[model samples]
Structure formats: C-alpha cells, structure tokens
Target: MPRFFCCLPLAVGVWLFSLLFFAWGTVLTVVGWYGVSSYERTDLALTRRQLVSLIITTSSWTLLPLITLFGMGAALARSPRALKAYSTALWFQFGFSVGAGAYFIYNLFRRNDGNFVTNCTSRDIADRDTCQQAFNVLRGVIVAVYVVIWLIEIWGGVIVTQYATERFQRSGGGVQFSNAPPPQGPGPVILDPVMMPPPEPPILGPAPPGRFAPNASGRFTPPGGQPQPSFVPTAGGVSLPPIIPIGQSAPQGQYAFAMPQNAHGPGAANQV
Candidate 1:
C-alpha cells in the first residue's frame, strides 16, 4: 500500500482556478479605477457592494494549456521535494475559489428597491434606466461566467485525484510518484594470483642436538657439521650400498661392509 499522497492534479486544478480568477478580478479592478461600466456610468458605493462577491468567470479556458505546462514542469523537475508547497498552494486556491464564489452568488440575488443590491447602479441622470438595464444583462452574463469557472474547478479537483491515481498505477510507482530509473550493475570482479608457501610443522622449544631447530633469530640452524654426501661402493663393476642384504654373504674376495680397524682379531686383517 502506498503511504504517501500524490496530489499533482489537485495542485494543477488550484493553480488554474487562481490564474483565471485573478484575471477576472483584474478586469473588475480596472473598471473600478476608471469609474466606468457598460455605459460610461458607475457609482462608487454600488460598485463596492457589487465587489463583495469577489469572483471571476472566464470563457474558453484560456489559461489551461499554459497552466498545464508550468504545473507538470514544477512537479516532475523537482518532485517529492516540491510536493509540500504544492499541496499548500492547492488548498489555498481551492478554498478561495469556493468561498468567494459562494459569497458573490449569494449576494447577487439580494434585492434593494427592486434593483439587485450587488449589481450596478447608474450615475447618468438622463440614461440611468438604460445603463442600469444594460448592466442587468451584463450581470447575468458575468454571473454565468463565475458559475462556469467554479463548476469546472470542482470537476477539476475530482479529475486531478483520479489522474494522480491512474498515473501512479500505470507507471507502477508507489506514493503517487513516477518511477525513477534503476541503478546500474556493479563493475566486474578481478581475480589475482598470490604466491605463498604452505606452513611447515613448528619446531617446539629447543630441538635435540644435531636436529633441525630455530635459533634465537627464528631461522633454522643447520646441524653443527657440513652435510656429508651419501656413499656408494663398487663390486664386480656393479654399484652397491655400503651395507648388503642380511641373508647374503659377499663373494669370496668381494667386500660388503669393511671392518673398521681389523676383521675379528689382530691377525684377521693379515690373512685377508
């Protein structure tokens, strides 16, 4: 479920209402400034009474397309960041349109001496009735204008809501926002070969004499003496190890393991 309200439509509707309304107000403002109406006659007191309604109505929706451009740009360009202010503007415009429209319409029908109290009063003595009559028809037209704008605004309010919902669903977005592009995949992984030697068994404490061991510096200390090469013997032109098989005896004149000093007795070596 989406937790955030997407109200772009409401914002747009409110903007259009305000732009068109203020535009209508601008016309009234000019009329009051120049002190003239349809027949070059207007009364200050009566004009003020008429202005109490304070609303405008426009034909052809002249501002709609321009408003659409600005509204969508503000929304999509800045997005979620701008939504707060946009919402506030929406409410203000909507409230003003409803409040002003209602006040004006209510007073438009108010009667005074058979003349609508909130309508034009003529200043011309000679053409007073004619000027007032022209204002009467113009007033109806003006009132219709206001009603149309108000109705359109109300309809816009509802439509904008649906538009926001449909856009969200169609775009598969949450919180009434358009979807943003997904992030790119990570860069390729690299494999490196490291040359390392496997660990050998540790030599504990002090090794026995003549055994491989580490000295104080942590390097292996060689045996006390230089290493002696393996020995091989030759008998009848065949190479043999220093010691032969236990069950075999050497040939009569051949030697296997030679006696160190003498054979068996002092005279044994003399006999060999």
Candidate 2:
C-alpha cells in the first residue's frame, strides 16, 4: 500500500541476492582451503601451520558475506544522518575487503612459487589457490553490492532533501518561502492613468468692452458709462437708497413736485 514497501523491497532484493552469492563463495573458500591444507598432492598431507591459516582465511571470507548483507541493507536507511553514516561505513568495509582479498590472493600464489603447474599439482597449493579465488570472487561481489547500495543512497538523499524543503516552505521557513504570501488586503484604488478633467465651456455674452466691471469702491459701472455710486448711510446709521441729499433737490427736472412752506427751514416761499 505504501510506496516505501514497493521501493524498499527492490533495494533489499538487490542486496540480499548479492549476499547469497557471496555466501556461496564463502562455502567454496572453506572447502578449497581445507582440501589444500590437509591433503598433499600425492597423499593429502597438511602441516599444522597450513591448517591454521586455512581456518583463519576461511573464517575471514565468511565475514565478507555477512558485511554484504548488513551493510547493503543500511544503505536504504530512512534517516538522512543514518544513510550518510551507512554509506561511509560501506566504503570503509569495501576498502578493507579489497585489501584483505588482494593479500590473501598474494599469499596463495606466492606460497606456490608462481608455478600454476605446481599450484594445481601440489595438494596444498591447489587448495590454497582455490581458496584465494573464492576470496577474490567475493571481493568483486561485495564491490558490486556497494555500487547498488550507493545508488539507493543517492536516491534516498534526494527524496529527503525534497521532503525537507517542502516542509520548510509550508512552515514559512525556507529560502523561497519567507514572505511568500502577504496578508490578504483590499486592493489599491486604480485611477484612470490617461484621464483628465473636462474643459470649462466658453461663456457666450457681450464682448469685454461692453461688460460691467466692479470699481475700487465696490460699485458696478454699467457698460453704457453711467456713474453708479454706492448707497450712503442716513442719520440713523442705516443704509439709505442712493438719492439726492435733503437740502439738495433732485436734478432740475428729474423730480416734479411742489416745495413745502418749510422748504427753506421756517418761512421759505412755496414753489412748484
């Protein structure tokens, strides 16, 4: 049901199959060494020293299969730190296995005096060569296992980095996530960029020469040139309509009326 189940098994299969193959080689190492150490070419004779080396060599080869099983499995670790540690460990194990395998092979051929004929004809040399070949085969197998394990490690690392990055983004903590979405707000008011106020219409009337304009005293002058004075204050301090003064009559014929007897104060003659 989980993706990990399907993918994890694929990883495990690769590692386990490698281990089984190496395990087979371990069995062959013991048999080959035992045969060479105990049996002379003519009568299967073995010295006690050769017997001890055989046991030690076979036992060491067995360790290779176990390391392949456990170390390769560790490459599929879920934790980032653990996976890194596993990868480092596998590398170290791989190096040690290579060195041990090379040394064992060297011992096998060197003890046989570089003669394949003698190596195969002598019981001890023949068995030693066989044991050395098995160790060599195991070395190759373990190397291949590590390669596959590293592939899985790389893939797993990528997944971890991606998952971690996504988690940080959701929490507003990652490089591309801080201030990602500003708090919701009403949008700015958009004024029309190219708009302008309408022009004031031209007023149609008489030309400037015929227009009425206010004077300094705040009286309006008619365009016809009439002198329009402002109204003056009366004795009661109230504004009176613009008219001739009491003592000063209206223009000679502008007003038509009879002069009263008291026109000249007390005894003035009445006049129409």
**Candidate 2 local lDDT, 167-205, one digit each (tens):** 345455545636567888876555442353222222244
Give model 2's TM-score versus the native structure: 0.30
Model 1, 58-174: lDDT tens digits are 212223333344445554653432333433444455566566556655565564322432233432343556655665675688678767766765555454444454444555564
* TM-score of model 1 (CA atoms): 0.37
Query: Which numbered prediction scores highest in TM-score against the true structure?
Result: 1
Residue 66 error for model 1, in Å?
13
Worst 10-residue lDDT window for candidate 2 reads: 198-207
Candidate 1 — which residues are off by over 4 angstroms? 1-49, 52-72, 78-88, 113-128, 166-272
